[model samples]
Target: MDFYHRAGLILDALDNKKGSVKGLCMAEAKKGRKAGEGARFLKVVVEVLKYRPHIQHLLTATKLLAQEPTLFVPPSSTAAVASALKSGSAASANKALKTPRKHVKAAPSPLSLASVMVHDLLFAKRGLTLPKEHKVRKKLEKYQPALEKENEREKRRRKVATNEGLQIALPEKVASSLEGIGKGKKRAHDADRFAEEGAGSDGAPGEIRWMRVNTLRWTVEAAVEWLEKCGWEMFEDVQEMLAAAQSKPKVFALDAHIEPLLALPAAVSLPTISAYQDGRLLAQDKASCMPAWVLLMPALLDAEERAEAGLLYVDDEDEDEEKKAAGGDAKGKGKAKSKGIRVLDATAAPGNKTTMAAALVATEGINGRVVACERDQGRFKVLKDMLKRADAKNVQPMNVDFLSLKPDDAKLKNVTHLLVDPSCSGSGIPSRLDHLLPSAPEDEQLARIRALSNFQLAIVSHALRFSGAQRVVYSTCSIWEQEDEGVVMRVLAKKEFREAGWRLAPRDEVMPTWERRGRVEACGGDETIADSLVRCLPEDGTNGFFVACFVKDETAAPIAAPALPAAAAAADEGEEDAALEPLEDEDVTEDASAPAVSAQPVKKGGKAAKKAKSTASQAARKAKDEVLGLASAPAAAKESGDAEVKAPAKKGGEGGKKLSKKQMYLLKKEELKRKKEAAQE
Candidate 1:
């Protein structure tokens, strides 16, 4: 009875818009509730919510609530009921609000309790959990035959043979037809349409249990051998695996596209397996694996090549030195600097992609660094635990927001690649039970997607700013076009991106063999850009997902510094003059005279390099105008000539005037300074 009582309270809270089913149950558990109480609440509550619509319809059709109103009336409402009968006035009923509980002759069962009882009566294998003599149970027993009849009618209407089929077979129109069931009140208690609860209930048909071998601790061969020892057989084709897995849960198949990933039946329980317990095998969805794989594919290929040629350890000292400079640990050799590959996982809490990247890096003795960033303190702790479990020693966990990080910061300056899997609307996650909850209003859902799109754009845009980044993979577990192709369109249209040579990596570099590309219309109808993007849905045997890769074009010529149009420039002359004001006069003079060519141009890449080039070019033109008496070149040409200024002195003088006596003296002094500097080197 206490169980039923607590369950009713949770359901009531859900109806009154207090919180989500899981959230409310967890809240209760935190308040000194019994262990496993929350789990029981979730299990019973989720099922009741899913079947409540049909159950309400059944009750109405059978007139069960009307015939047995006493059993359905709650104790709290008895005072009002008695007052209404006595005075036959709404005002008199309100006056009875303080009626004593013992004198009121209250009804034993509430509607919420009756509804849960009805669900168990019709659906549960062993009938109601209540005692046979319980008044609610005895009352429902009288309508058992009628309830059973309506249950069959429901199955007939949906053309399903078993009760389990109702889980996925319920039509949206059926729910819409029952609009009068819980009318008037807002359905604010419904779960987000996109929340994921992993695989459905036991023996769900056609559901695949996707798993990836964590190669950080062991090889794929070793994992397969261990599985064979545990009596699991490997099948070559996934279809064969699924077909045999229906009866034999010990069968598995290698995923064709993703090498280290495997497909098992949803019924297979790997949590108890030793390999899974220790984190050598992970239960990651096939869709979730795509982002890390796509981002690190090129690097993994290079690493494999080096391993095969026996060159992985050939220059240990040089590798360590590079790793130290890049702020990455080499071979778990402490925090010594090494020039190893570096990857940043922008929203890495839960560590799926973070550990995946680490494992991929370890596959061929590729010494690499992975910096996993998570802002939420609670989730950051989870990320640290996951990294430790996965034996991801190369990973450096940061409890800070990735958006707040400066790409030029010393620790992240040499990050060669990034994985931006930021928070999304979760609209694409396939849930086992969340659909049972009522959906958010359409306008509210759209507003949420808009907010999420802005966030996704901001995080990915930030990732592109990394100075040493060559490729950035922006991924989300969202199916919305706005968050997917729409974001890519906006990012590609950014002025900084175009000027920095950031473009979509070719399809060949992405998951080219995965047949589904992005929505063409979503990418503004450009087929090539759409083809470069990746999209996944549950129908593809994975959660709904999207991935887009942005790669820098190293071979592309440097962009000339940007110049405002003459008309626009004149219109904002005041603002431009203000912007040109020097922070410190001496600093400005030194910067203007200093060479614009960076000792390592690649280290100061992206927008930073471009801004420096533009500033230096403007200053050089100013010096030429003031000292040599040459007229300033047009804005476009003057900015364009910045790249040319890096040439030798002969090239600098080719089309310009010869050095004056004062300039000759300065040049001689600079030559002597350079000679001395070289001597010191």
Candidate 2:
């Protein structure tokens, strides 16, 4: 059959299948036609008609081209035909007839013919024209160049999109409508207020897969070798990776900005590597590692300082015994030493930071431990599992709310490092698709941001109160100024923090190589403090992240306590001397005089009278203590007796006022009750 004859048969079959071109093609391919060839023909035809805006227009255009052989043939074929005719040779004409023309099939399916015609009309540089009266002719002419370019682009886009299972094109109207919505000529005046400020008209870059080698499990060399074996090439530089990714068959590269971080092609799926299941590799973002890395600053500096001082610090063999002595009281009441480093993850869950911190501690060979706190039961289980998988032995996971933890809690008394990565809006994560959902109303979003900021401030401020804490890293995966610098400013502005002796560590000191600093002007924070804050944007090859490191200034003077009053000082001095008096002699005299003193009525008076009254009060107190049988009192009994004696002193005069009948009766009733209870025991 001829090309036109076959095209007619395909189109006729499609019409009978209710314009189901894809179904007809699939049925034909199953019956005997080459599946790949039939599918490719169907794809080309579908791409050409995809943006025509009307099914009727697609069918009409397809039918017209399928029915007419001349309209579907290319100009080159026509020229050859003409040249053969002019030669006046039957042999040349016959040869021209026998040769199959470009884009023309000896047995073309209906869909294939339609594809050739559509390509000629919309994409091919030269081809047969449609009838002037055709309904789609004027529209096609109006948007001919755009449609051609779009169809050409779709051919390239399909390869990546198909493998990723992602949609490359929106419906025709939706795509066109989006173009009109945001194409304003005037730039937004407040663009600087947003974290996406410097992103150009193209907006942020696409997301990429970031893999970090778990130094806890596998060395970088081992990880690189394993990945290379799986057909992945590692690039030493990020620019090199970017350059290589522009070509085909996606590649992987080591992240230039962060250690042990590897970047894989955005659209490629990682091969199933055993190392991943074994926890030798983790799929974590470059920015997410910033907190743990920043937290390691002190330990890094300590090592450098030791090296400079020519100190070969060795671990003590008696370290366990020393620590046992150091952790003396169950209440953690003794002064905690600064010799060892301890970290607290205030809101740890899924233990990313916890495991990272633990790994750093283990790798650095530091006398450090990480205390990971998670309140959520479900997430806590996940955290424990992750820690186990990461082989994090230095982490102590606690299922408890950070807010419920007191600054002086025994577990936290020795914690000198803190990490607060609280919950936020997660507005900056592009993959989370926050942008696709209709945004919450502006007021609602602001309210939510404010609430989040308050929570962030509370947790971070609480972390700073730890007595031994010398450094704290506050971080969040939020892009909004309210959740980033706003929280920082509020915490710093509090009056109590003035004496905290801590300030946001200068950015140049923490990750000095990083160029993206916080948006100080937009958030209205102190310029120096804001400059010290760090921000990571989606365009920066990271999930949007904010981190601020606070370090205690050891040189800053400690806050002085208010002085005691002169009278209180004198009183305390007197009590110190009195505490040395013989207890047995005092108790002996009081016990002998107890009955007479209890029967006597006390008189209130001045100095000499006060002296007389004081003597009587002491005798009464000693007698009461003897009656309570507390002379050889246990610690618990002493504490209880002291409390009871102090309670009645609040209502007394200088001479010690005589007990009223009601007070005496109540005291006797309490004594009887105590005696009854003790006897029963």
Candidate 3:
């Protein structure tokens, strides 16, 4: 007998008793001689359960036929079995009975037979069934008319329920009415209610096969045309395409939100598509594309501004010269080209954003360069391979911890933009099966989330410190407030960040067209910053994602220059060289004993000595500020020049009236008193 018929027999054998399907199946298998047949029997039983929930009712009906098989067994089957029994030879009987008699019917109850026939017919309707030549075929054929009538009745009932917006209740009224046969009325009512609510509900939004045309290889028009030639049909309306996807294999449509993105029917296998194999198409999530899109905003804005100023156009030769001047090779052939914008991609593994940034810059003819860094060696290798395959010429991959790189590293000096998509809990990604299921204990998951948020904060903090970094896009594939808005708020609250003039870029200024903004509650009720964030939830036809753009506040007041400590200034000035060089593997801590330095001179000296002393003091202060991250080295150097030029002039009374002899005498007396107090200490 085929597996389905065998499964029906097992259902009949359960005899309406409440028992574990798996346990009963396993017990039946042990009693069978052929192990493979037993395994196949279990497989069929599981499949049956997946589609049908009222197993008890199904079994109850089937059990009655087991006790009275004559009313249900096919006439031909009954005749054949009887004929074999009548043949007096014992050898003939043994041979006929060699196969398991569990499914073979000498007699059948009408109820059990009807139930089995109905199940097999339903499976057949759903395109799940055995071959036409199987032994169960004869029985199914005998019940064909009754089965067809019942099927038509069901179709009408479904039509009525759909039109009425009511849930499809149990098909057999007798199953609900009969006592001790199935669930009570209350349970049935709940099931019906649930079914009604879910009738039109598209379970999980169907997975969309999103493919982005690699503009580096092919334009969107060309890619679409190629797909058309390959037997794909493009729909103008995404809804129309999605509707058609339910019935067709290769229906495709342009993505409504993201450009150069096309959504293909979920049934269409991208790997089989020729363009994907050739790297002309990228299978990327729409949400995953947000980071690159946001990262490119600054460059695009700059281009627009330059265009408005009529300075956007540059000849090839002029561009090459500019590139050379900005540290590119004479031939402009190196990865570190200077004519385009520079981007730092922290945590850039698998190279999606890196390649996307390169593609965007290339499409705009901006000659942009991307510094893609990955900490994990394995992921770094993958990133390199992806970049190479994507034909991303503008990216320079680095296998180093982004946190380990100093904010003032020479390699990061030209990076005008930063893209940070750090490690996150990935709780928002439904595609990860583990994320779909219940995770570890609540405490454990919370701990992991906390650790991830801390790491995320550290990475973004480091990225913001890059000298001259005007824009940064921080993104995570986490839906948790801790990883998204929490990290943003914490980083923005840091004194270092405020000093550096960091603030969230307004959302309207970044991705103005995107409708879904971040959760304001997640940002601790800060609506201004919340509006600037972008969030993508799964129901929005994208993976859960959070992206926030930060930009340097050009209009904010410049941080005041830090003064040198008195101890630092008076320490022979010979210790300056040692302090300038950071000790290897040593943590630098502030010397609490060093009194805060003031800009004014405190000691009496000749004009020349005072000037020299002021100059040394400024240099020492600048060095200390750089080491302590109070100021960038380049900014400190510039400030040092201004202080030197202004210091002597103020003392010489060049810009203002000089103090009188009596006023100078009083200043000298006060200076002496302060000196006496310092000596007493």
Candidate 4:
């Protein structure tokens, strides 16, 4: 930057030079004034006293510093080198020095513009240039004529050639744009949707929808009142909205994304109002509702199975009594309430299924049990937080994998219900992606998928081993057959694991349901693994999902445990036990080669043991059913003085001082009512 810096730079550059060097005269430096080099200035002022004491020291120090790129003189200083033959980026900058004008001037030259452009390196590699202003405008305009000509030619070409797709009667100019293609695709998706929606001759969206929001956060009364305040005409009936929203878009209720999860048509009703915004209501998708609803329905299990569980059954012991009573229905007084309905969501992180089950379990005075698990520690933290926010004490979190758990893990050992949502590739949904997965080499991804599936099967297999489990519901986000039906098939084909007792939940007349599209029939009432699996298509709903519920029959003789460890095998051999068997041949797939899980960690071990032992006292678990059945009150406009209740209360805290346990439960019930009211509003 200064005299010493310049002198030092010259020497450094010379040192960089590997060949013979030439003269660097002060007169020559002055000759190159346009170059702005201080080399000449130093020569004129300082060089006047050549041979001054210790002058060479100054030159050497600067020269040594110049060896590093960090110490190089920047492009700004390079202007000084112009007379000698412009060097460095400054040479390019000098060329770009535009002819000074007051207004917009001509485009910059190719070589000069290269210095300033951010992507200049890319362009120079291809020997490309920035377009001149005229050229830019002209090139853009030129596309219209050429594309038009191409369109005309295409129209003539396709007029006679029939392709198996939508007939493109419109000319190329009209059909070749994105607008046209998007319209066509939307129409196609619509056609697919409509056919699925209107399947089996007759269907109504509202009839298909069974509204069940976990009123834990908002009272139904408050929810409804808030809805009425929002100005949409309220109806206690699903039929009204179905009849109207089907004919008119104005009647369309709920968010576009929410409808598919509901797997029903939009309602003339509204799910969002001030009431929805306050976190009291969520317009859950219909297809998403199926997994939880089926788990609640008792009829899904066989008649013998339900009766053995003490469900309402007209016994032969009551034949004479039944006749005396006229109708075989027991109405009123001594009706036995459902005794402890405990559900375990083995992979329940983020609690989507857990929350849904909590809602399903909600009823006046009914306290249901839900033991939720999340194997991954980090995700379990999220599950814990969600349960607290939802005020969902009915469900507890178990931080262990399903296989690591045994019958002892469940608070209710003989509880008939379990919900298993395994980790999976979200292949069933068609959400836009940054990049298509198939493009990558996929060795890692495929390997991961295999690993996850192996773990999922292990969980389901363990769940089936539990006593009196009427339903073993297995689900995944994956669309791959290998992960979906194929995995299920492997379980079904196990010699020790016959499909003896299982029926998937069917569509109920009063509740919303998913299309049971892929459940093919199995032999001898034996559900083929694929036949029992339900695949929820993304185009029909908010997510891609698979649900399969296995009903294990204790009445059937217990099959031998498949694949005993060598230690267990040796113990069995000593006694010649018939209850032990070799591993199923079909279970040995190339992808499922991971060694058996070694052992659960000590902390997970402690909680699971405490949890497993506590779960045994099933009768102690209470149900919120008294709170759940609060759907009795019809649509009612909130009283004017009611502070005009609106959307559900937003999450986090019980609003103010911490609530005592009893009060927290009631507050959640009130919130549920408010949520239902808000959805209407």
| Top model number, TM-score | 1
CA shift of 624, model 3, Å: 18
For candidate 1, the lDDT comes to 0.64
Q: Mark the regions of model 2 whose C-alpha exceeds 4 Å error after superposition.
A: 1-207, 225-231, 246-250, 304-318, 321-339, 435-438, 523-526, 557-681
lDDT, candidate 4, 636-681, per-residue tens: 1132111111222333756633322222333343334444555534
| Winner on TM-score (2 vs 4) | 2
Q: Give the poorly placed runs of model 4, Cα more than 4 Å off.
A: 1-212, 217-225, 233-272, 299-338, 409-414, 432-438, 442-448, 499-514, 519-531, 556-681
Best by lDDT: 1
Q: Give a tens-digit lDDT track for model 1, residues 1-681.
A: 556666777677666444445445544443444544445556566667877878787888899878876665554456345646577676766656556556564332466777787888888666788888987678779899998898889889989898776653444433332222212222211111001121111111236877789988878899889989999999988889988977887998999888899888865545447787778887788888999999999887877776676555223356657678768755555332334678888878667778999888666556777888876565576578779988999798987767556666786677888998776655565442346666768865555555455545556766886888899999877788876887787667556666778888899989989999988767656788889999988788887889999999867963332333332232223322222221211101111111111121112468987786556544444443333222332342244332112221233555653433222322333344444555534
| Superior candidate under TM-score, 1 versus 4 | 1
> Quick one: ranking by lDDT, best first?
1, 3, 2, 4
Error of 2 at 129 (Å): 49
User: Which of candidates 1 and 3 is the stronger one according to TM-score?
Assistant: 1
**Compared with the true structure, what per-residue lDDT tens digits does model 3 show for residues 246-278?**
788888899765677788764454446778778
Give candidate 4's whole-model lDDT.
0.41
Which is the winner by lDDT between candidate 1 and candidate 2? 1
At residue 284, candidate 3 shows an lDDT of 72
Deviation (Å) of 654 in candidate 2 = 34
Count steric clashes of candidate 4: 64
Candidate ordering by TM-score (highest first): 1, 3, 2, 4
